[model samples]
Target: MSQDEPKAKETKRLVVIGGRGDRAAGTVWLVGAGPGDPELLTVKALKVLQTADVVVHDGLVSDEILDLAPSRARRISVAKRKSRHSYAQDDINRMLVAFAHDGLTVVRLKGGDPFIFGRGGEELEACREAGVACKVVPGVTSALAAAAGAGAPLTHRGSAQAVTFVTGHASTGQVPDLDWDSLAKANQTVVIYMGVSTAAGISARLIDAGRAASTPALIVENASRADERRIVTTLSGLPEAAAEVAGPALLIVGEAMALAQAGTAELVSHVEARGRERGAKS
Candidate 1:
């Protein structure tokens, strides 16, 4: 082939490659990493992680889960702790949009189900406003994990007819101004996320609103992890019990909690053994 002919063919190939890159650039996926267990990740979420060009993840997400992503993927830790945010919500939203615009397949990996208090709704809205194509993949929330790990059934036939998951903190970092009366009378299982710091206030409000002080309550700390801890107490004791919970924890309160007695003793013993093993390893 003549020199000019070869050059023309090469130029056409470059243009096609550039067009393909442009076509694949503007997509984002909001994926849930589940409650501290990499194995809990959904197949779709795992596939997305494999193809992601960039992953922006939360603080509660496990490192093992992040390792599922392709080695070449750019990982960004935008994890937020109590009053400590590595990246503000607005900034994270902007970053996702900006990354997609740059032709990166962005993944916003959050702990638990993204829509469950993960600020994923706000991020989804941001993506919509920016005209970015986004998809959400749900994961197992910590409430469910905590209940399962503690051998508590969130909904028992004759005990709990429903279950409610609530956040203890508001945007101002204060106990949310929830309807205590309704919550107390609901008769369903109530799971409070991020309530460790506000356990005392939560217990007082529930009692003031007519909830039985003797209602069964359980606090599961570092749930689904090797060193997980479960503390069984009553509604009245939640405040004191929570004070001793050192790591990330979830609180479950309701009559259904009594069902925990079925196998909770064994589960607690297992957790204690795991804790000892971890301590020995350390």
Candidate 2:
């Protein structure tokens, strides 16, 4: 063949294989960052973060938890603070899809259990629709952490036979349309996540549905962390008691709340004494 014909053949070969470069595709991990403590992270979650190429974490994730990812990983903060949403759910979902499509290993880290009130289901559905390879890593939810922090057992032999977790807000940002009558039957623990803003309404609904106004209640804020706080009150005082709480809080209402109040008294007293001592020293 002539030299021109040989060059033409070589050009065609390069065009066919040049696009087949050894570029590694990426994946996304919908990892739960646990309640607030880094040590609460699951081994599998730590392993995923250690090698993640990119991390998109939520507002509640602690700084120590974010430190778990590789130093070279690109970290994106998509946190939604109180009254301020940095990124909407649809936007976050699209961002994850785009990151995965760009061939990067992404970790969508969230605080507490993703399935609880973290809107993880939405993100997971987005990934599925986009055909992105993704997996969910479960973490300790705030309900359990708050209960443990308050030294309360969610289920007691005779005090509580079941435990239910519910959100305070519906999709429309109003009080959820829950079966309040059934929930008022007692002998079960009810934990309300993100219910601080609606504490008064929830309390009213429960009492109207036959739950006693004298029912014990506890508000645990920043559960499982050093700055955790717990307030014990009656169902009628839930709204007022919750008003003093700051940061993400969980409300537990039931006979089990009585146990939490009694069990956590010593810890609360000790904490107070330490605070007093520090104040004196200062």
Candidate 3:
């Protein structure tokens, strides 16, 4: 039999396979579960979830989305927190390949667009090297949800002509080395993911690079979720604004952010406090 040829299964579920030579018996899909809201999940992702025999998902993926998978499917959580990983990247990759080799459909579900800092690329490489059939389903990244929930535009024709997404910390968990000169450019929006911890350094660097201290800034925490929060401030107050957030959040800086809603900072802080006290069920 040709290495790329798929052996068909007679189950009601339709297994979609992409032919690639020297592949394993089963297939692995990198599915994006989207930011928080189950409603935000793409139809294609929903279909893929329905057919999964084994699902390896990020810790942040909502419980509602996971409930969509078949009742008999095996679910594994690979949640990563600051300095704490439920499973190492190498281990996760091995699990996916091993599942596929057993002729099971595996779904490596991620909380945002898998390719958007979700380490989907690394998993994809691992699958290819293992000769496992792999495919991808993109999801709505948190940045877009953050902007929309705050009524801010990442790019506005009048105020912003460009948008840049950056991580605040490096893989080593230290402040990331970023180009302040370019990030300081006027008019373009800069969205920082996982930035709450490094807000002080990030704001200082941008200000030093000529970004106006008065530039508008927006912070969205637990974006798109029921416990979400939004804070609107100026570049000068970015760090202080971030101090109130205690969830997986994003920071947006640009003139376009001036249009965002901001009077709820105190109330949102209260809600977030209560949430933290109750603890996250997901």
Candidate 4:
């Protein structure tokens, strides 16, 4: 071999996990948008948002975070709130696949951790089936935000040995099928998402499963947001306490929740009054 023939030009080949004849496929990033605060976003999530060619986000993502993206990036809202859905789940999955096929970086942004009750698994499956590269960036879930905002510790030395996150609603908009017996165990905290509407049934089931009627329970609404509201009550008062909340709320049941910072006296009184009403009815 000749040593002076331009060193036989070394070619650097780019390898693509999934690519077409001449073009490499774009990647889809499933990013968690955090609870509600823009500042809560992970540094990598912020960078991905700023550089993505397209952002498909849920209702939980704040506008402030969206504004951080480049001005030219396209932003689409696929928010699903209770009974109303801006875009169907199937449509979103297809959309992500379609965007990646077009050789454009796509960001599928969800509120809280993408893997935690965010249907990120479904979307990730779709990407894999379509032969597209996908990456996940986790964000702090709302349960954590609720706990933080209320100054409550999800786990404590003697009060809570573990914590469980459960969805309150099923596909049928009914109480989700959860292991009530396990949740009723002591030294464990149970956090229910989208549980406001099913609080009555939840309270009844937990009580039937041996959870104490007087267990300290905290209902947090719009967690981490400026207009956050919290109601402190007992398991027996869950139904009435829930009736007083008109927004997205989380039901936290456990002894550790008793450490939550106290709310206004008026709110406390209201919770107590509702507890009394529920007791009178029983």
Candidate 5:
């Protein structure tokens, strides 16, 4: 517990693979790669990644993060886009389990927190069924990144008393069954993942369920990356705002979003203009 001990302490640096049972099987670590930013990776996740013999990552996981693994490590991308999956969930689970069974340390790198709509649960179940040891390393989900980028607090004492995360749609390309009634109540922030396509329907349902049409809304596209874009609007305008987003996006609604800043470029321009005017007057 000394500072020197802290400095000398090695992380979960397992260069050698070990597993349960009397076999040489390895373990599966579901590491969250964070929301597209390599620097956002946790220290533990980074250390585990260094020891990986194989990496199974999602499409959204940037190449920069993947490069952190030892150059000798094997990389397998199981990218999944809307309605297009290079490998089905079942297949991905099988791949992780199979890799671990071969005594190879496997890192299943996912963007954002794995459990948040990333289907980490299904994969964990598969590994348990196969008797493969598994561990999870948490990462900063996109919701936090998006909110931070906009300066919007997900829960504000005076405005947003609570926050909820919900998927935008189901596999059938339709709105998933959600408690729109509860969501319609004010004072709660609603962050919708993978919902840009069904933005119109989602807005209508919330409106019908008694949510205010003028609720402050924000659409963040490609959050936490260099190409990030933030659009601040209102609930009724969600459809139009979403129409401009072609990449992975999140739709956020709540009064707390009223404090959210507009795009960086516009804000910079506004500040610069004010500075010029003040200088001219002086």
Candidate 6:
């Protein structure tokens, strides 16, 4: 052996493999599938879906969007509903790394912007630690969909100057601890995700923080979907209005919500009518 030769390069043998040669290392793409509507998907996200070898997605991702993936791709749903998770976060993270190590293009498809309460950060961190090549393709989040569906501008020139997004429930399935005083401030729009079960508590906290009980509020369910429906009401009536919606919904609060194109009074009446019908059924 040469005196200066590196110890690791003792013997280099060039072996020839049969048919197909060694494949390149795999990569993971964290893609946002957008809110319900497939048309809202970004061009880059669509390309990834069409080319990926495997796709792991959440419950919120619609079937229409899933259909965009290539027919040869394997689709797995690790959807989380209410408190039920089909697969734990650790399991999903491991699955992505394993698939990538197998030289497959893996797509960790999530609903809405992956970084917005979608737990995409956890998955991305996993990839980083594993030394996997990862890319993020942003999509249209539900907040934007809800606002557009209702024709409500999140930040209005006169009524609202800032916007905030909050989750109603914490990881423990309890009301999330948030800054009520700041959330209740005027001239700001607050969009609460997964808040249907905690509507009453949210309303009480906001009222206690000096927000008016009569402040305009809107509950939009399945925003941007064909079955999308919205109920307009006052902050105090959030719980009552929320009771009428049972699908994936968002709670919008602020004076700017009053500017939505929908007829607030009529929707309020409709919600009240539906609530009465439900009570009669029970």
Model 3 Cα lDDT, one tens digit per residue, 1-282: 101112213110122232333654988999999999899999999999999988888889988899899888877777899889766788778778777877889999999899999999999999999888899999999999888877799999989999999999887776699999999999999999988899999999999999999999999988788888888998989999899988899999999999887644456557678999889653
Pairs of colliding residues, candidate 4 = none
Expressed as tens digits, the lDDT of each residue in 118-194 for candidate 6 is: 88899999989988789999988998988887888999998999999999998788789999999999989999999
Candidate 3 at residue 62, lDDT? 84
Candidate 2 to truth, TM: 0.85
- For candidate 4, the per-residue lDDT at 136 reads 98
The digit string of per-residue lDDT tens for model 2 on 1-282 reads 101112324433432343222455567899998999788999999999897877888878988888878877866777787668766777778777777776778899999988888889999999899788889999999888888778789999998999999988776777899999988988888999889989999999999999999999999888888777788898899999989877888999999888775324357768879999999999
At residue 5, what lDDT does model 3 achieve? 13
Give residue 25's lDDT in candidate 3 (0 to 100): 90
**Can you tell me which runs of candidate 2 are displaced by over 4 Å?**
1-24, 262-282
Best by lDDT: 5
- Estimated TM-score for each candidate: 0.85, 0.85, 0.85, 0.85, 0.87, 0.84
Query: Model 2, 164: alpha-carbon shift in Å?
Result: 0.8
lDDT of each: 0.81, 0.82, 0.85, 0.84, 0.86, 0.83
Candidate 1 wrongly placed segments (more than 4 Å): 1-24, 261-282
Rank the models by lDDT, top first: 5, 3, 4, 6, 2, 1
Deviation from native of the Cα of residue 156 in model 5, angstroms: 0.4
Off by over 4 Å in 3: 1-24, 263-282
Measure candidate 2: CA RMSD. 11.0
Query: Backbone clashes per model, in order?
Result: 2, 0, 0, 0, 0, 0
lDDT of 3 at 141: 97
